[model samples]
Target: MGWLRGDCVGRGSFATVNLAVCSQFTTPTVVKSSDVFSSSSLKNEKQVLDRLGLCPEIIRCFGDDYTTENGEDFYNLFLEYASGGTLFDQLKNHGGRLPESDVRRYIRSIIRGLAYIHDKGFVHCDIKLQNILVLGNGDVKIADFGLAKRTEEKQSMCECRGTPLSMSPESVNDNEYEPPADVWALGCAVVEMVTGKPAWNVKEGSNIFSLMLRIGLGDELPEVPNELSEAGKDFLSKCFVKDPRKRWTAEMLLKHPFVADNTLSSKTSSPRCHFDFPDWVSAGTASVPCSPESVEWSEWKFDSVRWSNCTSPVDRLRQLVTDKKPNWSESDSWCLVSRHQRTV
Candidate 1:
């Protein structure tokens, strides 16, 4: 890939940094990776995604090719650019927290994505917020196949590789772990999304011993927010459990009451605003993008004045929530307006 520094969105240990590949490629397109990893693992991820059959929720794999600059070959997996940015960005920006409802949303997406992957015989060995990207329209995509491996749907012991912050205790201990390890990381990501801090946020970043000290051992779990719905609390508790066998399944979490149907399941078809959200949703910055045809999106209204002015989260929140009406044109750019729940 002969891309420039401007194409760079991220850098990593093994691959060429996340750089925009196409020149004047304005709309964001994730480059297929040119990185290093075990052959079976990469092959597993490729076959798994291929079995997924072009899912919109998952990033699209453009093509696999060689990196001329690095002189090493790789499977190029390109995907959509989530302009709103990462869940990690949102969590950190707000001092390590977000609304519980929003956390539920992202977690739900994680479950769905994981289910799809697992259904196709693969385990996302690395599941973290940084690997979760968001589109402007509120949907999410799971990235980073470098560590993914094909596996049977059943649970079992598996080795692990990823940041310690999201590592499951079983995986951290180097025991036999399986898909449940990913669920554990998903739980960690969810907690971080709502609290804005890792389960064990301490002073020294390099003090591995110190970080481990914060992570309670077998049968010792962190204190979760009791305010979470019984379903939410129970769901995370199962996910964070020390025993992988005792952990919750991604499918089970998908069906949990908290995530049952929050996507479009509100009693009234009103937009999901942040006015009276609980501590977590009130705190997090993740959002579900509104489709223009969204009847729920059109009817929602808030203080545009506040959105247009202010220095606090209130103002920033209003900006993302604020609906922008597309300007009407006399000569419509390719007009064929068959009404289908118009937002305007």
Candidate 2:
């Protein structure tokens, strides 16, 4: 499709996400681009999305292509643009914690997506709040599958994958990432949503080796927040089971009372009910060009001003305003400025 890439929206370790306007579509799409030689993760994500097919809780991938710009080859993967940003951003916007009702709705959607992924014989290695994107309608979708892997592949890999805080015990101990690992990550995500803190108690200068030992060899599990309801605590208990063999699967979690009772119909009552469209969409048309390069300053008079002394245009303006202060003593009358009042 013919498209024009706009400003950069996000930057990952290996790729850059930008807004793009396509000729064939009305809504803007996000394009993640990376150097052709370093785009293995992007290619893998595209393949995984294609294999998973259509799911409302999963981010949709459009297509991918290769282009040469500035004599450098780049691989671009097109995906649906999420207007409400990531779940982490949602938490930050709402003073760090989300209402339990909203958390239930989001968790239900995540479980559904996880169940589908598990059934497809894959494990999402990374399942943190940052990887979950919120929609304009207060719904959530799983995104960023760069660390995803097939079930069989996960067993053979010895290196750990995914964020340290969300890593399951088995993943850290044996590098075994399966459906249960995703469930553990889900538990971590839920704790974060309800308590506005990481499931693991990581300190500012904590050693990585010590943290790994605690997760892999220690008997303790992530503390279920006291703020959670009885059913919510039970649900987390099943997820935080140290034994991966005994941990509840995503399919089982869907039937749990904490999330099973909640429905998308409650979205109207959610605190984040208002729409958050992108800045570009809300910015209306301008009569004159708005770019800095298009500005003309030749008409303004700079009387007895040393241009060399002024570092910027703002400094020049400040100097001019200070020099031309109004003489209040010469005025016979003064006008009071008050906030405009509307009449019913």
Candidate 3:
């Protein structure tokens, strides 16, 4: 496959993604390549994508090959080009957080992909906004399967892979995991989509040990984004359950109010909200190390109702700040305010 490689688009620990075009094809595509000696492991990812071929919500893989550039032998994988880039880029474009409706649509697509992958006996060990690719039509597809493995593959105890902030509690603690671990990561991605921040309050250069303790050993979980709807919060509660045995499966979560269509009845039960803090996290010897940017969230209200109007001064203030337009006299502004207030 003598495809002409063009500009480099992405760089990761294992591979570099570049724009590529073939003589027979009219559209630009992306090719991910890594040194043959590097551990990026394109072979495994190619196998996973090949087995999971033709999913509308998953990035398509054309084929793979070997190429040498500048005396280095490299293995390469060709993938569908997501013109809209990644979900992480999308979130940044929206000023850190995406609108709830967009988040709902993206999450629904992701669930479909996850369901298919799990049904096929594989787990997408890494599920984060950065691995989610947005298409030109605004649809999203799950990408980057380098860390994925078969459900039957035994994991080492306390084995951690993928991004730290998006990892599941079980992955952080016992290191034993199954499909539910992806659901946990999905929950973290949703929180990031809504809050423009990682699920933990910890920040850059903070104590990673403390972060892991909070995620794995605590009765406390990641803070639900304040901007999310009650249904959204409840949905996260299901994903963040301490017990994977009791966690909602992707099939079950599809019917959750947060992701289901408006006409679809949400038969989802209330998310579990109680647990004892792990002994290590609760040891009063020292407060968990935190960053200056760390945020403290209050208890989430599972039974809260959405507000339909700016019925109070506080609501008005919230509207003004969130909408970013303080024009009180314009009816259009009032409409904007009401629209966002409904998300409360």
lDDT of 2 by residue, 1-344 (tens): 67888889887445788997788656558998989887777888999999999999999999999988899999999988888989877887887788999899899999999999999988988888878988788888999887788986733332345666687888766667889999999999998888777676554333344556667875778867777776677777778888888777888778777888754332222112122111111111212211111222111101110112333323322322332322222111111111221100
List candidate 1 stretches off by more than 4 Å: 1-6, 17-28, 32-48, 70-76, 152-160, 201-206, 209-216, 261-344
Models sorted by TM-score, best on top: 3, 2, 1
lDDT of each: 0.53, 0.69, 0.68
TM match of model 1 to true structure: 0.63
What tens-digit string does per-residue lDDT give for candidate 3 at 256-306?
Answer: 767876543334334343431111221223222222122321111011112
Q: Name the top TM-score candidate.
A: 3
Number of the top lDDT candidate: 2
Q: After superposing candidate 3 on the true structure, give the runs of residues whose Cα lies further than 4 Å from its correct spot.
A: 24-27, 263-344
Which tens-of-lDDT digit does each residue in 1-344 have in candidate 1?
A: 44433366654323333545676455677664544442333444566567676655576554444443557555455556777667766665555567778887788777898888777667777677767887888788887565566564432222224454566676545433368878887887766566554554333212333333344354455545545555566566667667677666777667666677665332322123232122221223223212212232222211001011324322322223313432222110111112221110
RMSD of 3: 15.6
Question: Superposing all C-alpha atoms, what RMSD in Å does each candidate have to the true structure?
Answer: 17.7, 20.4, 15.6
